[model samples]
Target: MALLNQDSDENPTPGPPRTTEAQYVASRSALWSGVSALFTDGRGRVVLEDVDYRPARLLPGGAIDAGEAPSLAVAREVREELGLTRTFSRALAVDWVPPGAPGYPQGFPGEVIYVFDGGILAEGDFARIRLPEREVTGVRCVEPALLPHHMGPGNARRALAALHARINGTGPAVLEDGRSISPTCLDDLEVLRTPRKPQLWPWHTGPAPDELQVRQSWGWLFSEDGRGLVLIGQDTGSACLPGGTVEPADHDDPARTLRREAWEEAQVRISDPLYLGYLHDDTGSQPCARVRYAAAITDWEPPSLDEATGQTYTRLLATPEQAAQLFDWDSQAAPQLAAVRAAREELGLPAPVRQQLTELPSHRPIQSPAVR
Candidate 1:
């Protein structure tokens, strides 16, 4: 009689395996969970749901049903958990764990957790807000800075760290060790490295005549990640944050100018503008213009094609590291990159993980100048 191959056998003789009935639990039997970040009024105050005996103050989130999209699951969970109408910002993070991981409730042999940034609309009386009392015991709005003191173990800290980056800007911060805190929180600590500057030609064309000078405009610095500002492209070789000159038609509202410029350049529509600060650069000997604004973008959509030019500008979403790489390649954007890094650091943003790329030799390999 032919013998079964032990490695391929479906039912090989049991040895040290199957020590516990739970160990025999099929992976399919695992439950998936999601976490959410509820932003109230764009102030970076996030609502964390208190689940039964989980020992962590978590974002309002829950499990994804089999075959469900994580993004959809998070939105559904937010509504179900908070009983408030809301819309999610971009997906923030995804985490997975093996079944029976400590801290997870028993019977969850595996977990695929998704986290999203969301906004709450139509805030009702706290007493009237509906939640499944069995699963969620309470809901509280915790400031990003203060979350470390009250969040539950493990994932809560990671979620809070992302939130802090979203709120305070991107940079490094300290996280409590898992030995004394949840493993999820321990993973929240991150370091931001200096951005890499790009190489390109200078921005001076020997001062354009005043008649040809573009007026300085201002706009809010918004980001899809809620971390940094978005820049629009101009005739200058580099990219520029969305803002345009104060035209006679602008009606003296810099905020309106920002909105119009965003619509025109990036095709983005923004509401509820905030003031960041002013930036003036005349190094190029071009007409001097100063921009006054704040970096606060709560929502945005991708750019649409220009009806006239049919040209589409790319909207890049990057961490500080990636931005540095782009800046190093594009000379015109060097100043803007410096300004962004400075602004982020001055605002106490978390440091990014910095990696240095070695500089290439100045001389090129010998080759024919042209095949022609």
Candidate 2:
């Protein structure tokens, strides 16, 4: 009966006997990808979504559905999440994040993320953000510096890379594990370190032109070809423009203060410094207003050891895009730099060449006390 029967007791009817050994799985990788946007408002603050599940924030995107293109996925996400019917900017960055990458949720189902540039949204556009009550709790458009505070390290690095790509006019920046693999990445990218000293941030307080206490001066220096000059500090390894505090003896012109400091520190003679704008230094115990000037640098002298910091300053040349990256990305100096660029453009000045990855800091002047 067993030999004649079509179905056996141990084996299912008309099928091969089940094996005790585990079924073989294909030795292939199933990587999932998604698209996100670095949406900025007129003020240049990036848009982030705060979720209800965890404290970590995220860019406005989700997993790429099967049979969907990345670009299409981003457009869908923005429309669904932010309720905006729109097109996406060029792909600003493409990152290959492994499973369990920082910024991904538990059960993150992907190996790559495509970050797109969602060009600056006006204030009206910012007000248009409507969150899906089930997923996101609230939305925030804040300065780029606070990205790390809101999002995970991986997401922050990738977003910054996308910003760099958009500002410098470079193609998508490629990265792995929060570090860039592309050769054009910024030389002084401060992604590797954590805050050693606490910044005394007053939370988006714009500079008070009339109610300032101290006066400091910095120069917006350019080369003959119009590339900007950047100074990298030896002691702190921080990037800053070449300039310093204003003394009572600096006379009526803050540019003279810059000139004196330039000569003393970098050993360069500053040409005529036209005041671009002023930045409020709000990171210290004492708040001050910083005066900025735009000028050309000439007659270089080898830098001496900075007596104050006891570390030697390294002088380097950078383009406008480069200078923007070299400085603190979310500093008040950003507006001054933009003003200088605008004035130059209006005057038909030569444009600078971006030698490496660009950085996009916000150009929107901080309008109100808490509007940043």
Candidate 3:
């Protein structure tokens, strides 16, 4: 039997009293609900179904029956929808939604979407599949990169955004125009479109005034062995520490941002970051804010690039002495080196050997006569 096959009109014994907007507008009380595996192939593509030709596509899964467990509901739904018997490894996330949200046509007061990490066991998983054509008109696997293109209005879009964020481990939902929608309190929703650009040094100017660019700075402290400190060099010819600017959607302790950035940029895992002082610099016109930390390398590895960017690099650690020398000679490496050294010494490491680079004035003359 299909999970959650009952109709709304049935009004099966009411569980909890239907919550109102006033109760949950600023409250933490949330309904307990469950959704099935936004099942992805090895390539991480999720299965989507078009319902009754609705503009919005949906991941297959449904609410848990009274007294039924969330994980059990997930497994049952997967079997009924995709004809696959699977097991749940763990619950990934419990999505909380507000009451009376106008997104779902079913008039669901709210939902607590529990995502389960699951896997199929047998080749017969694809056999004997029967889709309820009235409810599920069409089905296909949608690559995460293309989800936004197929997403419809309301809860469907929100679910896609949340799932995408969970899968990619990156910022607010990235839209087709490259715009991003960050999670926010309802009061702050109005400012979602306003771009917050990072302050940069005058020499670092390139993005237009209206373009949204955020500045992020972090320390990349490494020991002599290439194992302790991790760094990745981008094709843009800029050497940056592993972290980036903080976003509003980050829920972990702010310090986690340091570790998160390190993993993303250099694919190295950082733990126990010692708090360091913050730095402020201006690229002539733009202001940049940097939060520094001294961290121990609990684990390290080579970096991987997301599909959005094709550039790649290896992670390497260098001694303080070597770092100072290398940074002194390379223009791009100089500033990052200084920052890392300062952080290391603050954490009681040996004072880094210092090498100085002489600043040179620009040689190109302004307003030169054009050659015919």
User: In candidate 1, where is summed lDDT lowest over 10 consecutive residues?
Assistant: 185-194
For each candidate, the alpha-carbon lDDT, in order, equals 0.49, 0.67, 0.49
Off by over 4 Å in 1: 1-41, 52-55, 87-89, 120-128, 132-134, 164-372
What value of lDDT does candidate 3 attain over all alpha carbons? Answer: 0.49
List pairs with backbone clashes in candidate 3: 198-215, 199-286, 199-287, 200-283, 200-286, 201-283, 202-283, 202-284, 226-317
Displacement of the residue 133 alpha carbon in candidate 1, Å: 4.7
Q: Which one wins by lDDT: 2 or 3?
A: 2
lDDT of 2 by residue, 230-331 (tens): 666654545677888888888756778888888777777867777676655577677877666777765666677777556666666667655554334444
- State how far residue 210 of model 2 sits from its true place (Å): 13
Tens digit of per-residue lDDT, candidate 3, span 319-367: 4433222121223334544555666665556653322211111121245
Q: Candidate 2, which ten residues in sequence have the lowest lDDT sum? A: 191-200
Superposed by TM-score, candidate 1 places the C-alpha of residue 281 at a distance from the truth, in angstroms, of 28
> Each candidate's root-mean-square deviation in Å?
16.9, 12.3, 20.9
Error of 1 at 23 (Å): 18
When summed lDDT is taken over every stretch of 10 residues in candidate 3, the lowest stretch is 355-364
